[model samples]
Target chain A: MKKMGKERPGQPGMDRRDFLIRLAKAGATVGVAAGVGYFLHDPFGPRASAEKPPGVLPDFIVPGVGKKIAIATGGGRIKAIDGAIEALGGMGSFIKKGDRVLMKVNCAFASPPSLCATTSPELVAEVTRLCFRAGAASVAVTDNPINDPESCFSLSGIGEAARSSGAELILPRESLFTEFTAPGSSLIRDWPVFTGAFTGVTKLIGICPVKDHHRSGASMAMKNWYGFIGGRRNIFHQNIHTFIKDLALMIKPTLVILDGTFTMVSNGPTGGSLSDLKKTETMIASTDQVAADSAGARLLGKTAKDLPFIMQAERAGVGTADFESLKPYRVSIG
Target chain B: MRRAGVLETCIGVFLLTLLAVIAGGVYWYGANPPKSASGRGPGVSGVPLGVAANLPADLAPFGREETFDPGTLSDKIDGKADLYLSTGFVELTVRRFAKKTDAKSWIELSVYQMRDSAGAFSVYSLQKRKDSKPLNLASSGGGDSAYRTADAIFFAAGPKYFEITSSAPGLMGDMKILAINLVKGQPRSGGLTIESFFPHKFLDRSTISLHMKDVFSMSGLDRVYTAVYTDRGCQVTAFISRRKSPKEAEDIAAAYGKFLLENGGVAAGEMIDAPGAKIYKVFDTYEVVMHRGAFFAGAHEVDKLESAKDVALRVYRKISEVVR
Candidate 1:
């Protein structure tokens, strides 16, 4: 909880000379307070820049966790999702009765699903349906899009899919964000987080498509957390790897779904040409984000060492980079 | 009487000051009018409102045109904003026309005005691919470099980059006619004449490309022109770039040499016949790089060292002739 700024007192019918004097006095007071606050909270000061908010813990860890990852292949997106979730011991293993599940989907671009820049709406609908069938109280689909929020959601067809599957669509608004601090980050100190959507959410799931990123090399489950951050986040591109590692440590997701049904091979993050896409027809469900991203990197013809964030996250003790050692359950469906 | 005189003088001064302020306001308004309020016509700076009139009337199309400056171009082509921004985009005019005969048959024409010819060439060159078919039109540079897809045609003339995409197939002819008209409507600002340095004897017109930045995955190597040539079942890629100075050109050529050596390329020593030219064997092909004056030229992916030397010397001689 943060205090609001003090409102300026109205000075009706005041003379111009008197008003100027009052404004000068107020300005001096604000300048002194700001200087003192800066010394106390400056990112470059002796004090630690990142601080975790109260009452928030890593919610991604499931009790009695078993297999680390599941890889499903040779099916459409919906089938692949179902098979992957089933291999991980079904949706019931994660979502219990009356649990509010938040599905953070990759709707970064307003591109149609055929472009393979966003998660498939059909997969979102199926996941929502499965969550409800598993006795979840409610399911919500949300993302802070790179393009216009409403247009990205609508064009990607995720909005309609969530509605038909009885899930609410949450779009980020300016007023809905709250300032958040990461516990141990070099870049992200105090930043805006869409806290309104996370209210009362018991379990969190990330559904993102594997695609080439112009800056980060590849975008997967770990990179999907970028949508949860607000403000002029584009500046983070200067230090993309560090920001991504910080993001991995910020949120603990119950499960992550990596959509590889159609992976964008080149000019990605926002692919404009259909030629840039390659059909891998695969999906992965995992409890370890670093392991999931490592698998996604391999799909892009890269190793975990190739992407700095993967290794960085691994060293940060967020998850494991040795995805093969996790012994991911592999299945093929017609 | 003295007090009355002072009052009159004050009133006169106030009236004069008011008059000056009004005159200044009028001048400022004229000089800084909004883009929409500017006169609409056709040219390098004209914002044509009736864009459909510029098209062939037989197409029977309804047109909607919008103009954007650097601040607002992202609202239109959000996905490709980075590409346009990198090219020094100044203004963009987009016209969407749908055929009245069949609404499904439509075309969109986008004209991007860049800062200069280099900027226009950058935007045009980045989109060029090896498979794009040549489109012959009567624009600047003869429009011979224009490439067409099944539904889109892209070309650049002067500091203007043009893209005309149609919804229906087999609109290549119509797109060409439209491009010619667009070129005819605007004043000629000149084309990238440096492209002519490549020899015409063995040049593959379809394979000619300009890379604004990062040629051969090497960053900071900007404004590079490349073309492919085939002779006796051997293919060669010729590249040329103009740098700020002779020293810069030499440094870039040396950097490329080092990059090749670090990436599995073996040094094959200098070409004795051509002074200042180095040869290397890289990935089953003979590579040669040379610097002449402010221009650095190279030939790569040739089957034989002699063929590589032949193309490299030719480009080297051409750059010397053009630059000198």
Candidate 2:
């Protein structure tokens, strides 16, 4: 009757003596774990710089140049990019002889080229050609696309652009990603970055279409740096404005080309249809990412005030949101 | 007992546990099985996403159907996944179909299964293109409505929100037919729609939308339904949100007023007709906030004071009718 009133042990291994033995086994496991931890701890040996929080990014900014922005309005992609770059002291000014350039393009989707969700293929090809012509040693095209790397590259015509131009297409893989955390960053702590593509990279150039983002107000220059992130990066979109601010701090590119040839004004970031695009017919090139996005916002019928990331980036001292403050050169194309 | 016997017993117990786990798993999965993105599932009383993914026979399947749970929803949709996740996301099933006649022609079908009818509609209305033409899907087949752009058809029926984006624009007819066929497969239910609460008088039905969270930059002020109206030469936005209690509604209304005040809004005194209603002049625009029973109502960012008051009064009376 006493046994019936009490809850019995479910198994023979859970008897009183067996329970004590299990407890002892758990204690031993803890002891072993502590011992291993103690053994691995190298107190007073190489503690200063070893296993540092950062695998630091190379300084890709074009130093010794004052902040500049150039806007080319109403022209073909080639003419606009050419005119904008010419205004900003030309491609040769940034990409020097023997300089290795990394082209960070937004191949975020594997959609049709007409959709303009990804960076234009012609833009990538043209940029690569210009970098090589500027006496660059090697110019590699890379992006950690949201879709399958091969498909995003192939269907977006970026793969063909890179292949035909002889620019190394560094497709993101698990092996290529390195965990990165920026100093004083809130969002991108211990985050995997496509760092392998940055190997021996001297100058970095950002090339992406200005599109209406459903989460962030606009996907422009700073948002393009989101491509460098890996390992389920979509989580960052929760604090999207902060994430874009972090991206601004992460990459300091030489030239950011905001392709507004046909801005995805609505249903964006992943615009499925041709109607989503509007022929804003403008190209913004800048040494400052904040200024580029600020100008790009106009194409989307938005000001810097509409996108919180613009002010956040400005507050972070990444760049100034006031494109006018930079004394921007505005040119009209035929 | 010999050491080898104890080892054998532990191994036997471990194997038994493993077998039991495997058996339990098999039974559970058999009952709630892994379904293809195109396959239909049973609906739950609460937010059942009876996903009914389909395509017309004219188009062939381009690739294998893909599915994503809440955790990996961002993988497929990227940053936009945040909006759905923050709302009431469940599962997403994606399948691409190519035109039989032309290999280059393709359409990507993204079917989002939200928590309920409200969640689905919130997503659909939130992402509705400015130039979308309304489609009568409920009359044609199932409940609720649909809209189509040049190259896409976005519609919410029951708990399922459908987005079909094609390669080219002007594929509306084909996509509409595809949407109709897809809608026919799902069970019809009048999902939780809060937009009807907004008075039809001077209300733009096309602009009627439900914002799930962070409406007007207020953190806790959520599940807000807002619509624009062309009243008195000004496009005034009328907002409404249903709270759990009358007190909660009052508190949010006050907080919204306070939020505006903190951000450079000036008190413009109370309205003449409505008691417990306040108005504010913010940056030359008029803003009004009020609450009645379990509903918080307001008008925001209106150019004209009369327009703002008119929309607010209408919304207030509309809620008063319901809660009273």
Candidate 3:
């Protein structure tokens, strides 16, 4: 066996023992300096108390492939939903046989559907029926509302529609959320996420209504995922554009459906008066959430470039802001 | 010699271990950032902490008060004031009073303390609409304006903006009473003196406004006071911004001019008489911007270039005199 500090012959340097001594002395001096420097200037000390941990991506996500968006206009909610989804291929294209489907619907407020603040019950019911007809084993409807969950679901008429359509209305309970970490995100780290609806669910669908948001410019399909967040998530609004883009990165849904039957022109996300709403009678279905929101913006007389979130999401490689380039299928349902 | 060698080796190992410990500490801190305390707290900027005590108790109402720092303001307004966070928002206090008889019969009072009066006015003006009914309140002046809806009253005074909302009918009287009390609690200060610099001739009093954040959708311009005027069958708007320094004012004026040129406006050959003022014609309307001392003023949407320059120069002269 060779000695511990034995040097090989023909090597042009000090003996192994001498080299080891010098290296140890140099390392010791550097390490002591580094330790003192760390004490003097702790670069990674506690951050601002208001700063939140990064948001977490969903554990199970359905990848989007060859995504297409379809816009159906000139019809009631049910007809528009049908025409839009059919144009995107069909219900069978998203929901497969024996799949457990989870529908994330926007029930942000307890207001009735006529106020256009929440998703229309007729549209939710029709989509539930379509999923079941496509051979989905179970369809669960869920939302973490801004108002009281039970009242929001019940008064919004979404509860009755889900029950009558043979779907389970999953109300978010305190125990249902789990702390999740979204790695490599400046915002939304170690946040509470509603995990109850994801149990045994193989497919995910997002249903949202287009409306003018006082902060985010507009709330569309991408904003629909805000329902999955729990706790004091409103703090995310401090950087509304980044939060929206982070949401797009967090959830990868099978399909995104934008309900524009009655677009809220102003004072929205929670419109109180009927005068704030306009009957656009439109629906957009797409596999790409960013693309769906880009098209939905047009219904509110805004372009993709007008919203910071849409541009940010596009730049983040989530989807394209040039939604027109996708050559969406346009239909008129009478 | 052998003992010294062993001592050096041990010291090196000890230092290396200490460095590792420090590195681990940093990583742990980065991984787990501190979180704000989750509950109601005292008011910011030495504002009264007990908001409920200041309110009338005989209203037969139950009250709750919450104070929010700039980072957590979204919690107070449910994200409604997210846009204002960029404008130097400091803190906010929200007091909610609800009658026991009906949950819908409630009053929500919010007091926002910004970095300065300019920031407060910016948030106030952003929320104001042209259709709202103007209210004559004791605190209305110096970049302060009050407007009311059937159930809501919004006003700004000094470094604070107030919002009083009620779901109950016929609460305007109560709102006014609350406003007077709120003004009493605030520090007395002069109104936005910039309003006095505008020429009263051809000025429309009702149209006078101070845009806190941006003017006409153009960014980098804050604390801009604007008023409309009727001149020879044409309507024109004159705006002025009092910046911290002349250089800063000049930069903003230049930025506004560049914005106009980028947005389909053409630079005109005839310049305004004021030092550093440029004229532009955009969409059949003339626009002019100028800077004097710490004051930046401009006129936009006039029918003719000469008329726009005339308004711009007059406002610029007035601001220069005030600065002098």
Candidate 4:
């Protein structure tokens, strides 16, 4: 009878205290396990980073660092056109006769050049003239837009200048793209991109307008590479900074021209009101995307301290932020 | 009086013993319930259920350029994928590799139920291969979801996939998920399918394989089961793999064939026997397709094993329709 009581079916023991204690223990265990499990599955974990071969990390870092072209931050005088060409060694350095030169501009935002959110027409025209002067080849300007392609180009000012300067305007599609790999990026492994536009080019120029972004706190040279992405753009917002670095790792641009003629101080990448526009009148150019962006940030009265991404780019050895290291040549552009 | 005290002590001991047994039973039930046959339900939102799940947790929260939109889940394991928002079910999908040192200890798969502030159903957190002993392998490669996210494609909304790679200094494993957009209980485009898809645009010239060739002859599916032969055979010369699930096997083959075709191999033809068997062949020493219910017999070359295993998984991925 005693044994039967011990094995008693429903209420094995009449006391509820022990049941409560076990429940508490189970809850605690599950909670700890949940935390550990969640952390272990983090995307930055070893398994994720292990996917890309070691060759990928330095691959993005090399051109990013080597391409640092510094513009004059002294005297407040801006050299928008000559500064860009000169930093890339006067166009003769890269463009040769019969070489196909492709220039990728950000026409994704439907805004004019004065807003400082779109690539300036003057910047595009100067690059085109430089390419034509350097070679007996074709120079084409185009972009993959998040909005209507033609409208973005025509209204943004890149389309007219590109056509007049003897550069063809191409729309982004599958035909323009090819695949490339990010060697050591935990986020990006290998992906397809605009191949013909990016590959085998004697000279490639990046024209990005400095703007404020809700996500990265700022949009500059590194952020502009998002336009070259072939298939998907929304996923970039998932892990924005790591991917920005990854994209920076892939695009080894010869010149990163910041069109700071009309700086978008606050709301940007698409500023509706003219209130966000400020007359910074100073266009910064550099072979180092990091340096140009850093200089541009300083002009806006914000230092690299506020932007974690700029600091990150600098740490990754993408470019120089120290104004002292760069030889600035101040020239007035009317 | 002493006798009475002993009797009372016995009853108290009996009650404690009974309580322990009941508590243990409850613990066992909570820890190990029969897993659902088809696994947990999909994301209630229109997003793909397993997009992030497709990539290893370490390879997730990847956003291209300046975009780190780690889908709708913002817990950081793979960098900073912290800005996700959704009102439906979300989950993590962890994947385990068969060749890892601690593969057995890791979570083969797990599910977590999520709810929004309204206490409504939100995300189904699925974690695959969640636990494993620390590996001693050197660094090898990373996953695609992070890079894709970094590049700004919402891969978490694309397809359910995973990969295990071992490179020079390290070995790696990952799970990737395709985002799901639920439409009246159906899935959006780009989700996984259970049927073999046409590799090339033309279906008539596709390769096929079989086991127990005579069995297909008896079953009258021979017209459907095509056969081919190559130089290598078994585990040494050919490809052999054991998958954890039918879905996994199918996914591997599809992805492998895609890789091969993309890399420059042509689908010359296919061979078959019983669904799964002991013997297998390598058509080009670079590729092999195993039918359902097959075990590889020998070891294969190191260079070709990866590709061959991938093709085998692809075959398994699309093995749902064996209609007579």
RMSD of 2: 6.7
Model 1 lDDT per residue over B23-93, tens place: 78976986664432121333543434344456666464333345667655544453355677766799887
**Tens digits of per-residue lDDT for model 4, B143-247:** 112111110111111222211211111222232222111111221222112113312222222122212111212221111223222314432223233345556
Against the hidden reference, what TM-scores do the models get?
A: 0.73, 0.81, 0.66, 0.42
Candidate 1, residue A172: lDDT: 87
- Candidate 2's TM-score: 0.81
Per-residue lDDT tens digits for candidate 3, residues B1-324, read 134467779997999899799999987986765333123443352224345455555344333345677655544344465656766788876655655556545566778887877667666665564456777676532324677766677877788888776645755676776676676645543546777888887887657666766567886566778888777767778988788899998888888888999999998855536767888888899888888888888897788766677777778778877777
Q: Residues A27-134, candidate 1: write the lDDT tens digits.
A: 998999789768756456332224645324346567798548999998888888999999999999999999999999988765556667788889899999999999
Q: What's the CA error at residue B246 for candidate 2, in Å?
A: 4.9
TM-score for chain A as predicted in candidate 2: 0.86
- Of 3 and 4, the candidate ahead on DockQ is 3
How are the candidates ranked when ordered by TM-score, highest leading? 2, 1, 3, 4
Better of 2 and 3 by TM-score: 2
Report DockQ per prediction, comma-separated: 0.11, 0.34, 0.21, 0.01
After superposition, candidate 4 runs with Cα above 4 Å error:
A1-79, A83-89, A178-180, B1-324
Cα DockQ of the candidate 2 complex? 0.34
Candidate 1 structure lDDT: 0.77
